[model samples]
Target: MGSGDLNLLKSWNPKLVKNREKVWIKEQELLKENEILKQKQLEITKERELDSLVDPHHKHKNSKKNGLEWMYSDPTHNEDYLLGKKSLDSSVISKNNLKNDSKVDSKIDSEQTKKFDYSNDDPMSKFKIAKKRHIIQTKEKISKPTSPL
Candidate 1:
């Protein structure tokens, strides 16, 4: 259609333009709300991290009813229970735990070169075996395998 015809059509359909404007306004509002929620989440996470640093077992203390319940219950928790776990660590472990232990350890090492501090309540720090294996592998790799006769 001609530019003039298009202009005429637009002039005719003021309601359509208003609807689009309304939709755009709603979308902008939603985006702002989402940003606000994200900021709140970040603040909450930072607070939790601070609390954890001060009291290493803050989560455990609050969640568990008693010492026996905490001990007897399965130490392992599902991904849902472990907040911020997935977000922090991007490395994926192989399905065969026994066979891929070394590989996963290496991956973890390459991903995180710095030694894990026990005081830092890192979600990935739960895998003590992986860190131990990585440390052993790192030492082994450094020393020359050939022995002089």
Candidate 2:
């Protein structure tokens, strides 16, 4: 080959080499990222497996209820029941106080009445309106003028 061809080859060769090196570096990075992702996926799967194994709900069907009770119940289980009763009593006292507070009671009554009114409204009426509007919009779109000539 002539010097011109040699020069051209030399110029092109470094670029090709650089391109190949870039591709190789990118592949390595991708491989590293893929490995990290795979490890994360493995960790997630291991966590799920461990969670399933440790979960009281996943115990043998016959033992599940007892396992759940044991897992969730306080260390001194009776204490929890007593505390629950105390909380119930406290709530009752608070409810009585609210009833005695005329302003609070009125507000609560108004809120409850509004909720009752909303509940009394037929839920299906909203669905029917939505369906009717959808049909009307669809028909309008379908019947829209195509073009002006």
Worst 10 residues of 1 by lDDT: 87-96
Q: Which ten residues in a row have the lowest lDDT in candidate 2?
A: 72-81
Q: Pick the candidate with the highest lDDT.
A: 2
lDDT of 1 by residue, 1-149 (tens): 55554543664464577767888899999999999999999998997788689878657644533447655432343354266555322233233344356566776776475455655466576577678889999998888586789
- Cα-based lDDT at residue 119, candidate 1: 51
TM-score of each: 0.32, 0.34
Every candidate's CA RMSD: 19.4, 19.1
In candidate 2, how many Å is residue 53 off? Answer: 1.1
lDDT of 2 by residue, 1-149 (tens): 55564644664464467767988899999999999999999998997688678874654434333346654432432344477654446766676566557655675677577556464257798788889999999999999987888
* Regions of model 1 farther than 4 Å from truth: 1-15, 63-149
TM-score of 1: 0.32
Assess each prediction's global lDDT (C-alpha) against the native. Answer: 0.65, 0.68
